[model samples]
Target chain A: MIWPFITRSLGIATILLLAAIGELLDERAGVLNVGIEGLMLFGGAAGFLAALKWGLLAGFIVGTIVGGAFGLLHAVLSITLKVNQVVSGMGIWLFAMGFVTYWADRYSGPLPMGMVSPSIHGLSPMFFIALAILFAIWFILSRTHLGLKIRSVGEDPSTAEVSGVNVVKIRYLCTTIGGLLGGLAGAFLTLTYLACWSHLPTMGLGWVALALVQFSIWRPPILLAGALLFGFIWQFAISPETIYAGIPAPLPVLRMLPFAVTIIFLTVISSERFRKKWALAKPAALGQPYIKE
Target chain B: MIGLRFPKLKCERIVILTGADAVKISALSVVISFMLFGAFVAFEGTDPLVAYEHIFSFAFDPKLGLPITLHRGFFLVFNTLAFIIPMAAGIWNIGMEGQFYLGTIGAFAVAYSFPDLNQAILIPLMLISGAIFGAAYGALAGFLKGKMNVNEVVVTIMLNNIAFWLVYLLTVGGPWAGIAESTSKPLPKNACAPMVWNTPFTSIFVIVVAILVYFFLKKTTIGYQIRTLGSNPIVAKHVGISAPKISVIVMAIGGAIAGLSGYHMWAGDPAFLMIPRPEAYKAIGDLTYWGIILGLICLLNPLTSVPASIFIGSIIVGTTVLVRRLRMPFGLDVLFLGIISLVFAAFQFFHQYRIRRVKVVIGK
Candidate 1:
């Protein structure tokens, strides 16, 4: 039971970790791409469509490509246009919802009705791809000079610029890459997990990832921990049969405990004492648009 | 982009914008939003002209689509006004969705308990219960923000998830078993707020409440402080006005107002569930992000939300009709709306702020 739960949780974590690592890079670069949700949704749809038309690898590539494109858009708007972070984030959500949904519907082909691609077996190629990405992103963020520059840019782009770092370029690259990761995560949901191209298919995973970012807080390693926690939560709890029985209805309330815990965690993290002492070193200028002027 | 005509000179316009400017800006935004929406429809293999005609006729058709459009707009208006209140006070409660869902469950719980109460009494009571439920939820975020300094956006977003699952459990597990996954039983007919007009344009209670809110914000001392805090929380704090307390109070008030929509939606709309239906939209219980969209369109003002909500309502109605008729995929409206808003914001920036470009001169 534990191994099965762990495997399922690990599978879930792998998906989230892919997104979280990308977000970490994004946050480290000081650009909070709140449109992560929309990015993921678009990625999921794109990946599903690709898989439906071509194959699994093609779907994965399309998902990543779509996600990267959105990341680039975020970089352009937030870094160049200097739009408000929240506003830009909202734009991402709206644009993804609108653009992908329309495209998916327009290009839709006959697979099985409601199914985007048939599964290979119990697991999918995208699932394995997600696991590989988790490690790849972890290595890139922790080990590479590019990663260091990206982190420095997030930490203090002004200082990084002074120190000869191409802060703008670094940010643009990281955000785009992060978006790719986010898209891959989304594609995994459609092509692997559900094997369907769904409208707004990523659901609230992007939002949950944002929360996980907070819970994990500046640690690449902790992405796994946070993802595992979340995986255990949304997956393990609230069996449908148990709910259908309706003997004790408070199970629904119990299902909320994980989300509620996020609230509690945030409250704790933001406490004055916590902020002063244990506050994760957020990219110092995180979420602020990069304005050269 | 032109070179700075007045190089090294300060560009200052001292004229204050009147209501006319505000009206014009909003009007331009509406017009521009539609132009973009037209472009979207054209992209979907449909003729823009025919689509517009269909949208207009369907929206005002009065028999089939008008009521549904207005019914849909009711929550948008409710959510817009709800978020705008605290937003005016400088508190961004991204958790309005969670608070809304809480209101749904709370009001539903109350109404479900007293099934035989008169519509008048039941509606008011359910609304009150909604207010209380939303207030409590808002207070949690406010308390955290006030005491902990955790960003309200993150906290509220998380809370929205919590609220969603909470409602999910209630619908599936508890006393009320909704027909769908994220819905609850419809309230008794008598439990609904009475329609102000026989037409589904707007609910009477919402109109009355909006007026009262406009006056309260314009006239009341607390409202003044709320507005003041929004502009400069630190300054308000320096003046010993208690920013944290105001944040809590304002957010609670905002949640309560938002809850009214949930209460009335369940009461009046053909209730398939305790919560608003999510046939096409993915996120059902959480209306926070959409509320933020409304907040931005209305500049965080409830008075503006009235018309803004209607405009947005029409967009949703128009888009829904188009998608259904065209078999367009879900959430196309969100994409079109986002692009339009970005364009509108970008244009508005250009309209208001002058960005001077520097030019270099070669040696003569």
Candidate 2:
């Protein structure tokens, strides 16, 4: 029984895990892409539309491309134009939300029959893909020179520039990759997990993924843990009886648990003592835009 | 081939814009954004001109339009202030939506608890309690950000979800469950804000608050300190300013303003409290989002936010007209707003740096 519960949690957590890993990479390059939520939404709509018209493979490809495009837009706005990252990110989110919503309303009608996924050895292929990506990201960040350059750019772009790294190009590349992962995560939601396109299907998972980045302190492995924890909390909220004999509180209150836990964890990690303790994990210049002056 | 020498071209010096040039560029950006939006509307099969006409006619119809527009604009004033005040201190209080709902809950708690109070007494009590509740909620996020160094954006977003659920638990199936599943009983008549000869409670209150905020920001010592802190925190610290305390104070004030908007939303218009429908939730979310955009457009100036609020309010009213009359899809206003703000953000870059073309002289 516990095994099934854990498996279910992992299945649900794939979306968060993938998006959080993407954000981890993005933040490691010192570009905090707050528009991940919007990018994911755009990907969901794009993937769903393409899946309806063509096939699931097309859905994934189109979703990723759309997400990458938005990521490029964010890069242009934040990196090239030097807009305030927060405003531009939020603007991207609004644009994605509005545009996707408008198009989805006109296009998406109902889920076609038999669109659900077939389980692979009692687990989802998407979950395995997420795990593979997580391992790949961890390996890249920990073992590669390119990863070192990305980290250097995040930590101190001036030093990196003096060291002859192209800070702008690295940032753009990382942001686009982050967006691709975010798009893939959204595709997973539509093509595998929910198996149907719904308005804002990613919901606030993109945000939860963002918080998980902070919780993980930019480490990919720790992000996997944070995503699973949030996922289990959500599952527990929705299906409390599966674990316990009776319900604890009202469903609404139960649903608040995941968000409340995120706050508590964020507060704990944000403390000066903890930050000092984990100094290496925290990116020194996470959200600041790098201008070659 | 030997006679193919090119004429010498003079290069224009690329100088950063200042003062009037910056303003002109910003105005141009706004116009460009509108033109793009007009094109988008035209693509949707409605003549952009016709859409604009309907929007203006609906928003300016004296008998119906004037009151509704003012009513909507009044709430925006408070919401926009909720964003700009904290923003002036360089903090993003995106949790205004949560604070608004919490304020409604606070006002309703007071009004529901005291059923027979005098109108004069109950009104002030509700407003004060509402503001205090909102302040407390806002201060929670501020404290986390200031002391714990938490990312206020993430915290505020989480708090938004938490606040919605709390409201849902209270109004849906918990202690304050209404006659209907998602609504509470109407506030007592005495608790409702009294109207002045055809004007709303918010119209008067928003102006008063706007004036107070303007003076407080422009003429007060703390306000000056806040402005200094926002521009340069390192310098501010050298000058003995407490960043944490200021953050908490600014957020609290912002929360108070948003809380007042909640009170107005509840008692001023629909005159009852309900868990907003999903569509209404989208509208409220857009309201705060646009409030932030408007605040930025006004360069975080409170006095300017008043007119900005009215302009945004007119847009909101216009979108509603578009939906009702032209059968356009929902959330077009937010899409337009998103594009406009993006254009302006790009323009901010141009305002700072100019691009110039230089001719290369051969054999120099």
Q: Write the residue-wise lDDT of candidate 1 on A221-276 in tens digits.
A: 77777887877676655442322455453555666666677777777776676686
Tell me the deviation in Å of residue B129 in model 1.
1.1
Give the candidate number with the greatest TM-score: 2
Expressed as tens digits, the lDDT of each residue in A1-293 for candidate 2 is: 67667767776699899888888998999998888898888888898899888877888899888888888888898888777788778878877777776677566555577765667655678887899999998888889999899999999999999999999999999899889988888877777767776666665778889999988978887888888888899778767777886776768888788889999999888777788856677788787888777
Individual DockQ of the candidates?
0.46, 0.67
> Across residues B103-182, which tens digit of lDDT does each residue of candidate 1 receive?
87778888889989976687678878988999888887887777677778777877776777676666654457666555
Query: In candidate 1, which residue pairs get closer than 3 Å at backbone N, Cα or C atoms, i.e. clash?
Result: A29-A154, A30-A154, A98-B335, A252-B169, B97-B287, B119-B190, B184-B273, B184-B274
Top-scoring candidate (DockQ): 2
Model 1 vs truth, CA RMSD: 4.6
> What's the C-alpha lDDT at position A41 in model 1?
82
- Candidate 1 — which residues are off by over 4 angstroms? A105-148, A238-251, A278-280, B1-29, B178-186, B199-202, B270-289, B323-335, B341-364
lDDT of each: 0.71, 0.80
